[model samples]
Target: MAGNDQAACADGPDFGPLAIEARGLVKRFDGVTAVDGVDLTVPRGAVYGILGPNGAGKTTTLRMLLGIIDPDRGYRRILGADRPHDVAHAIGYLPEERGLYPAMKAVDAIAFVGALRGLPLKEGRRRGRELLEQHGLGYAADRQIRQLSKGMAQQVQILGTLVHKPRLVIFDEPFSGLDALNQGKLERMMHGLAQDGTTVIFSTHVIAHAERLCDEVAIIAGGKVPFAGPVDVARDRIPAQVRLETRAQDGPWRAALPADARHEGSFWFFSLPDTGIEPLLRALIEGEAGILSLSIERAGLHDAFVAIAGEAAARALEQEKPEELRR
Candidate 1:
């Protein structure tokens, strides 16, 4: 039955101009909807992030896309194949649950994982050793997984995921167990992969990582996507903010300030007026408002997430718990 499905996916219509496409994807478990009408479009060679709080259906959505679980309604294509596992050879996936044989040596575990993905044992071992050495894990290559620290073991699994040199890589909550140094290393590795033209997708509640690493992102909340597009586009949904420090708090120019503007000490904060800053600046100068300092800054991914997904979802991100518990 699986073989027949693979054949059908192989012969299915090509999904043009996108690395991943999904329309109205829906999934449910035990009569409870976990994902609802989620859609995504990921371009080739881009680093895309699925950004959401815990239990917001990120894992379920990823599973549906990867064919690990089927959606109740809707369709998806990965690497132009109608079924994701049909092109399994071209993809690498790192699940949230981390596991490796404790008795196996680090390099052997990596090689073993590659072998499951159809890489020959001999060549996989060679690549595994090379990967370990390149990533500064050469000294631990011969050490058993049980001998390594949790972070080191996780690093071995990450290398194993890449040993086969896949075209599309998906990582679910890949940063959970790593220390700050390992997290920095992983960020660099992701950048290197994107530079080599690989498509990278990851799910995370960490807005900082998505802001720094993702070219595009989808913001999911309450099992629905509120926004999905280039990172810049999401941030641009809110206008730039203005911070003005003036020596004079009371002047004719005060009327030019936004009605909702607030001040702390000498600084005033408000959104950039739709009329633009030029008019405001002219008014300030003419009224001798004594502008001391001025800065206009666009909203960041965190602020954008709050605005798009709501405060409830933002709180969920801050107080992250196991997804199962939330569900």
Candidate 2:
């Protein structure tokens, strides 16, 4: 449904224009702040991720941006509309709490969702069937919701979200119940959506998924955003790691190593020198250190998250289950 509408930019993906913008957004529940001055700027046609641990206000922040609930403070704009609901027809939302009528056929269910977004019932049904066929669910089209597996049912709902061909799509914890195969399918779907100039946003505590799919991310902890920017920028906060194995350890090359360098077995590890690797390379070669293997490893999103949001937040991300499961 995505690539049919708009062709991707010629040179590269154009994430210049802003699709959603929020400033100093704050929300409270019973006087306890749920979102604290969260700010975000999501670019058009970009796949953006909101990363945080459970109870870190990611959902609350998304709710505020969608105008599902009024923020206690701050303002937001969606698709250039002052009120998000004014342009609701152009937006698709797959909330964390998934639900559909158990009695309805999968196609009928998808069509019904499209109808709510102002799509013609007849056209919706036609598109629903086509979508089902495209997503390898054609055999299940006539089947009732209750007849499908949990994953299949969720896929139906996701197809419903896209039936209207929304310009902007938001998914909250869409991967929670999905198997690895389904998760990969969803990732491809998000990529297709972005390539078609659709602004895609999703929230997740799983750093791996975000790292793989998101062009940019906002890392939240304790209801506050510690860092929000391009994934590369976040990863750049920590220095690259250097791993070196040499034939001779006691040489001039050893002196070139950083003060913080540590030896373990036959390898020496340390952060990449601020002066850069060229000097170190020259020293090693000139000193005849007999380099066996040398590697520079950049920090991953998980490491960056720990550095930015602290170890406690990272632990919460690893330990916390989905809200529904916890409940």
Candidate 3:
């Protein structure tokens, strides 16, 4: 079996090369397809993101890849293993639904999680304390999970995920509930992991987080990924845009605007074509159009999502609850 060969080839659950590779993954629930055929690849030492809206099958896909649930049809290779369970010891998973014993102290909870991942009790406790101190939560280490603030609890849970020093860390909506300050801390932690040659993959409904953190991203919508690749490639889906607010709405300057120019409120917005804006500026000047303000905006991940996934998905994303709530 491929799994047997892989197990024998490595001393442990080594990544070999890629941290994750899945192909033609499909899963259904009660006859309704939850995940369509999908392929995902994540390289070692990279920060990858699975981005989608609520109920978009991101969770289903991740579950299948992790071997938490069997796929209706597909195959996955995680950390050189034919199945995730074969390499479970190399992975640290933080599920979307976070739970900790309410009565357990923060440090003890972390050590318990580490123990579940095969770490020794004493080592787990030692690492837990160090992690808490490094993350500015040393004072809360003795506090009960229920006594800590939401942000403190979240940090404690994340520290537990890393207590075993996994080669690949997977987080399902790790930012689901946190304030801006805590979110920043999580971002820094992810970057640190990648710098240390640990692969990080996380699912998120929030575009800003992925845009800021991901080296590569997959945009899942309608139970499928319409786009997946480098973050820069996605941003390039749309060209730079120029927004101009002018006193004169009509005149030769009107002709200067691109046919695709969109009028929104007092400003006209149009893609900044490769031909450049010099000609447009001259035309506006010749037409005596009083330009109130002009600005150029680069395409963002949200814009790419709208272009690839459609306005409906983009609207849903904007309307989705703030990444703050119990999963």
Candidate 4:
């Protein structure tokens, strides 16, 4: 049973080596080429993120890796195992599109999913209840899932995915339909799982969470990966920039830096090709411009994402131009 092997990750890193690896991964649906030659690598026990705009093939890529859909080309490995289907016992997935047994009680819903994964019936029920209560949905154990709020229902789905205690977890837009409160809860849950040695890979269009939650990130667009690196390393590579909010007077910072600095209201922001910012900062202290605040601004995943996904999102938008024009 899949559940019998579900806790297999507890003994060691799945199959060891790379937790997830894909080279020249390609997939097509209806001949549109949803995923094209994408490559990815994820370390064991790390929180990895994939950022992309809609239709950038993030979902399709995940589907292929999870063995739900077959990629037309390329190769992938999970926990050193080439067969994703065979490794299903160690993986849990939450898709952007949700499916639940609405008529079933919340506890029963989660248990049902665990049962399919080969979880023992008694343990499945126990885990279902524990996860529900831990997520603050305990009181709704006997309540029908359809009667819960959208956010509560979303939680039920998330619980279902992890009920069997899989070693690798994948979330597709896990934060899409929730308020700030619930999003925070999910974030905490993810962190907790990672601390327990679960390897996690999730995709999102939002950059802030990826910046905070992931050790490394990959930005994909046009069915390809344009950037993949450690968050700090990626920030350092994109050019060092600075933001200063000071009095609008003739400050030395304005005079000492390169001439290309931009003024946004009273704030001056500029990027330096070189990292030697000491000279400029020293000049600012000497001038006494009453510097309200100074902050180093590095290029973030959002910037790289925009630089990469911009073209793809635009193409998707353009494809809908005719329908939009009709409106």
Query: Which has the greatest TM-score?
Result: 2
lDDT of 4 at 118: 73
| Candidate 4 C-alpha lDDT tens digits along 1-327 | 012223334333436646899999998877788888988999877889987777788899999889888789999988777888777867889999988878999888888887777777678778788777666678998899889999898988888888888889999999878777888888877777777778889998667778889999887878888778787776665676788777647854557766678888878888863647777777777887767887886787655555655765635534533342335
Compute the lDDT for candidate 4: 0.78
Q: What's model 4's TM-score?
A: 0.83
Model 1 regions more than 4 Å off: 1-16, 321-327
Clashes of each: 0, 0, 0, 0
> Whole-model lDDT for model 2 versus the true structure?
0.89
- State the weakest 10-residue window (summed lDDT) of model 4: 1-10
Candidate 2 lDDT score at position 84? 88
Candidate 2 worst ten-residue window by lDDT: 5-14
What local lDDT does model 1 show for residue 167?
A: 75
Residue 34 error for model 2, in Å? 0.3
Candidate 3: misplaced stretches above 4 Å? Answer: 1-17, 244-257, 262-268, 275-294, 323-327
Best by lDDT: 2
* TM-score of every model versus the real structure: 0.91, 0.94, 0.84, 0.83
Clashes of 4: 0
How well is each residue in 1-327 modelled by candidate 2, as lDDT tens digits? 233422332222222489899999999899899999999999998999999998999999998888899999999988887798887877888999999999999999999998988888998899898888887899999999999999999999999988888888899999989987898899999999998888999999988889999999999999999899999999999999999999996876678889989999999999998899999999999998999999999999999999999999988987864554344
lDDT by residue for model 1 over 205-281, one digit each (tens)?
98888999999999999889989999999999898999999989798999999987998888999999999999999
